[model samples]
Target: MSVPPAPALPVVGDGLLDRLLPSVATSLGVAGLARPGDRVLEPARRAVVVLVDGLGAELLARRGGHAPYLRGLAAAPGSRSVACGFPSTTATSMATFGTGRLAGEHGLVGYEAYDPATGRAFNELSWEDGPAPRAWQPHPTVFEAASAAGVEAVRVGPGFFDGSGLTEAALRGGRFVAASSLAQRVDATLAALRTRPRALVYLYWGDLDKVGHVHGCGSWQWGEELEAVDAELRRLAASLPPDCALHVTADHGMVDVAMDRRLDVAHEPDLAAGVAEVSGEPRSVQLHCLPGAVDDVLAAWRGRLGEDAVVVTRDEAVSAGWFGPVEDRVRPRIGEVVATMTGELAVGDSRRHRPELLALVGLHGSVTLDEVAVPWLCAPARRA
Candidate 1:
């Protein structure tokens, strides 16, 4: 596919994280603080990127001791945090990381969106059973680019994701290695790294995120999971062959919305008046208002949501760089107004759908520092 030039949008205050440049620059041989090229730019070598599903920078900062390996990475000189794009949700942020494009361009939009074409909420993550991957998101991932460039790329995750819709749309390029256990995943990642001199191995761990969503980020189980994952990374780092590098990052962070703050649109008539549809997560509510009701929607949302959220029109969000450079194709996916939850939850009729969402102990999809910021950790490759 021909790479189209990104639009000429002003690259400022887009709320899109600038911290990702270092990683992209490092991977592609551009100069940056954590430039992998400095050490592993050799034509034949290995590079490992471990993506911990729900680990955020703020979470790391508060509970550094919980994960010693990751803590050391964050505290290391030159380590920093990057902002996840608007809504700060996992699917959207991961697509951005994989394709190196904004949500507007990739068109993943949110975790669940009312697919205009389908007239129902399309869940991108589970689309393997929901829709064809290419039909949902047609863009080529950066993994494919690396593979075609002869840089061997491998994706190591759980068995369930081997052929899932999320994998195809955002992570289609690499060879898939499904491992159900952390030990298995770590082993698979190390094995893939040893196969080629120049390799990109992407590893994913989702248990922490799962625990957080179930028990909230404050649970001891979630902290223990972080420690366990960190221990696995440390083991992998120690076993790296000579002349390699390992980098650690995440899709986004988590925020635990209070139960008292939960507002059901079904029961709240004022909040439902102008809203044509409510998609995205409760924290990041995408309000598709009735025709000519954009202003009324904004006002109602602001008046109702109050200081608990950052309410902005879709145009304002695009102008503010919320989605990076908005592409012509991605514009329609955004609603006339979006309310990013700040201090509470704006849940739908949880009785009808999203029991898990209502039960989630930890939440995300907001601009709060906890949800948007992620860490960048780099270490010299381990040599055998």
Candidate 2:
């Protein structure tokens, strides 16, 4: 007997995140943003979206023993996690989630985006009073609608993120509640929920991502962080008011890219030829080619990368619906060629940035299920 082939690539409408957006928007009472769904979460007084960074569906399942509470939630009915769009990184994924739009519409192309206007590669998440949020993201977040529709909207996270560029770009328009720890975030979320009859609280946790970046996804440190996240989720769920509901999800997942498998484009002269700039993480790369070098660039990369990655021309990705319906405005943000790693790796030029990026133990920014599938754990309304 032979094993069946893996399921087909996820379609735009069928992915987990696409289906959950409407339910979430409806529960929060934001009129137009939500898609159609059964309003199972009743009482609808308040809704919370707990975003756990790096907790992908596959990682949550394989590493569930470390996260008992979260695991239980996934096992429950009406609880599911879905794959995020291409280049499963936090910046792009969060923008997709906050806007209810695909990456193509939102223009948050990746973790390290080459801003077309500036022609510079910068970390969007680490922006510090440098760029204008509206100019950078140029998309209206769902929070904007929540605030306009008279729902009390709030963002609960670390004090450092009170006005970070990514927060403002993808999740601004809500009141910021600064908290230092998971417990504080939980307390903040509950307080925000009860402040008004219609409220939308967006809570964030970064422990899992932090641990996974430092230690591999299979490490003891990552496990401990998952346990802490699980405990916090359970605490938040139990403390919700009678009319409230909680939706726990994540930005992306993690995969351990062995150092030996990493292909350093800087070292590979053929792969680097005609390539103007390289952006994205170790697992995914967007290669911008010089004028009229697009074909040569693609052929060279496809020939060199071989089976280690999937090398698709920008048009191919756009036509294939990789980033949802590609918008004209987003075309420039995408490169002439996009390389998504499958079994091997794509490394950054350590000479270009910090050493820590190269040293990261766990990584993402690929289309693989391990990096794209995120869990959506919903807690039924307490008094419904």
The TM-scores of all predictions, comma-separated, are: 0.88, 0.93
What is the Cα-based lDDT of residue 287 in candidate 1?
78
Give per-residue CA lDDT, model 1, range 219-338, as digits (tens): 898888988998999898888877677778788889877778788888888878877777787778787788888887778778888888777888877877677777776677787778
Which residue pairs clash in candidate 1? 14-321, 44-197, 45-197, 216-361, 216-362, 241-383, 242-383, 242-384, 244-381
Q: What's the C-alpha lDDT at position 216 in model 1?
A: 83
Whole-model lDDT, model 2: 0.79
lDDT of each: 0.73, 0.79
Q: How high a TM-score does candidate 2 get?
A: 0.93
lDDT of 1: 0.73
Give candidate 2's root-mean-square deviation (CA, Å): 4.1
- Model 1 regions more than 4 Å off: 1-44, 128-131, 382-384
Q: Residues 282-343, candidate 2, lDDT per residue (tens digit)?
A: 78888888999888888887788788778887777777777777778778888878888887
Q: What's the CA error at residue 373 for candidate 1, in Å?
A: 0.4
